[model samples]
Target: MKMSNLAVDICGVKLKNPIIAASGTFGFGEAFTSYMDISRIGAITVTGITLEPRLGNPPPRIAETPSGILNSVGLQNPGINYFLDAELPELRKYDTAIIVNINGNTIDEYCSLARILDSHPIDLIELNISCPNVKEGGLAFGAHPDTVYEVTKAVKANTKKPLIVKLTPNTSDIRETAKAAVEAGCDGLSLINTLLGMAIDIKKRRPILANITGGLSGPAIKPIALRMVWEVAQVVDVPIVGMGGIMDGTDAVEFLLAGATGIGVGTANLVDPTACVDILDELKDYMIENKIEDIRDLIGALRI
Candidate 1:
């Protein structure tokens, strides 16, 4: 299917394609530049940056499961300052849009980052509210509608750049949370930020990951991610960046049909460093075979 259109405008930022490298999987967008042309990607969501540098969790941070993996990296990063100073410059050379994923132990830290990044040249700021909220008794801000609204509102008050609130699937009703973010003034939403999961080593009689619990991601959670995306899409008016375990073009198409304006490629990168570009090709092929002239036609095209 010789196509001419693949560009998508996500929350005011233009992207060449609909596939974005999910945060945490792609580290600052520098590591994958060696394997593929980073410019070919739609956008790159950098690793989760914190207020200060962190070493992350101890060894055995990753554990392979049936069709997915458990990761307890604990948001280890070089801090936002280093990222703005060191990483941003290098990534800016790429043609794709730059979206930074940020986390904080407190609402103050989140607002601080937002205020600072608002003055930068970045395209968007994705709030990683999946992290534990120390002030709220260790619950993730994204899990509760009130916290989600408050945090989203506070961050939005400080930033002029487009804000994309990344939601957790651990909530009882993801739709309510999505609505809260939209009400709080988020420009877009990214759903299914790794389901809570764990694995055990029988012989050792202990948990496989040192953190005891971790985020499960890969093809195993694609179905759940799709459902959440569909649910949120039905309730909210903001764009949804759906992600979970998208590995191929067919998987990417499924997300678009589920009402995702943009697709996030996560574990696929670990499986194949060139997965982003490869999936873009597959998406084009799928569109061609399906007689789809424009990729945007696939968004929310699912029939009941």
Candidate 2:
């Protein structure tokens, strides 16, 4: 099948395929250059950027689990100036769409970052309201629908680029948050960031991660991610980028069937450097085998 068969659109941005390199995993699209052709990705959501640089959490920040990993990396990244001065220029040369994920400790900080990025050459702005590992701004603004609306509306007012709000799975009802974000003016939404969880070291009699608690990711959260995406899709007409434990083509297909316009490959990248391209190939094979031509045909095509 041709590559065009896998093309997808998120908001107004056109992706060559539905495979998006999720934030925190793809590392600004440059670190993976030696692993695979970064241009093959549909879009790249760079690491979470903040108004100021963050030292992140202490060591022992990542712990392996049965089918997943718990992480408390704490949104470690250079400040926005460094990203704009050092990273954005190099990323502009790539063929894929560029989605910058921005986070802040307050609504003003979020607006400031969006305002600064408005003049630059980016395809989209992903308002990272759902980072569970952080202490201040991320999950705090995401957990409540009212706060989600306030922050999303504030950020949307400050930028011209399409805003895609990434939602947290820790919320009581993700659909409420999704509705609030859309009502607040977000152009699109990304669901099921990471589930709140932790693990304990029996031998040491202590928590595995230094933070004691962390965000759970990988295959363990796929089912929950799909359910949230499906539930949110039923309530909103905007595009949805579904992520969490998307390790293979079959997993990507599941998200699409559940109503994700874009598929986010997170932990799979850590498991395989070429996972994005590998999954893209596998998805194409599945399409051809099923006699499906256009990739859009699979979006929201789940059979009840």
Candidate 3:
């Protein structure tokens, strides 16, 4: 017997399963098609986009820490038009849902971006409030409850599509941010974005990343992400998309135990673009071995 039925709903969008490839690492959701049947996983969130194309931050934008990598990619992307004209149509060939992750430097930026996708055939609009909020005098919009409320409110009011708020791990109270977004009208929350961290070069006596500090991701952040997911789960009823250094089915299972309805595989994709398929395979085996009839039964079912 197999236990492959792990379908879960996030903001009314039903995924074939709860495991998904996170943005940034998945490259517009088309790059991994040859490695595996793209439709086998849940939904795919494309890399973050902006109103216009971006070259991203300068080189040395990535640094390898002990168990993770620090990146300041600056959300480099080909802009929304490219996605609309090129990526979306091809991706629509599959039955899976394609979500565009949008980032902005200002409130109007968030609203304007939402308006762009308002009538588009996308499944959801994920506001990247984790982008440092200059509107809050350079504080990350996802860092504070107030900023989360305001940004989410603006986007929610502007767009009719399901709005998902991607939260940052830098905050002291992720649960507070989760509640704030929901209060501000967010339909769901994807959390545990890269932790703020840095790496160094002893020979240069300077930081390794050009940005000095960057988002830390990969297996190193899994434990903390799980704890945060569980904590946020206790506070909010909205669906949670848990991610951070998730590299295998076991990692995905850990996130489910922490109350995450869906799991995003980020750095693991970079480690092996095929990790999603392998993780899916492992998940099947684990379910059957445990005598679990359906994977959803494992979600948020940890007994302690």
Best-fitting candidate, scored by lDDT: 2
Candidate 1 residue lDDT tens string, 173-204: 99998999999999999987988888999999
Task: Report per-prediction Cα RMSD to one decimal.
Answer: 1.6, 1.0, 1.9
lDDT of 3 by residue, 120-209 (tens): 999988888775312332236888999899989988999999998999988888889899999999988998788888888999999888
Clashes of each: 0, 0, 1
Better of 1 and 3 by lDDT: 1
Clashing pairs in 3: 218-245
Better of 1 and 2 by lDDT: 2
In TM-score terms, which candidate is top? Answer: 2
Worst-scoring 10-residue span by lDDT in model 1: 131-140
TM-score of 3: 0.95
Which order, best to worst by TM-score? 2, 1, 3
Q: Which ranges of candidate 2 are over 4 A from the true structure? A: 1-4
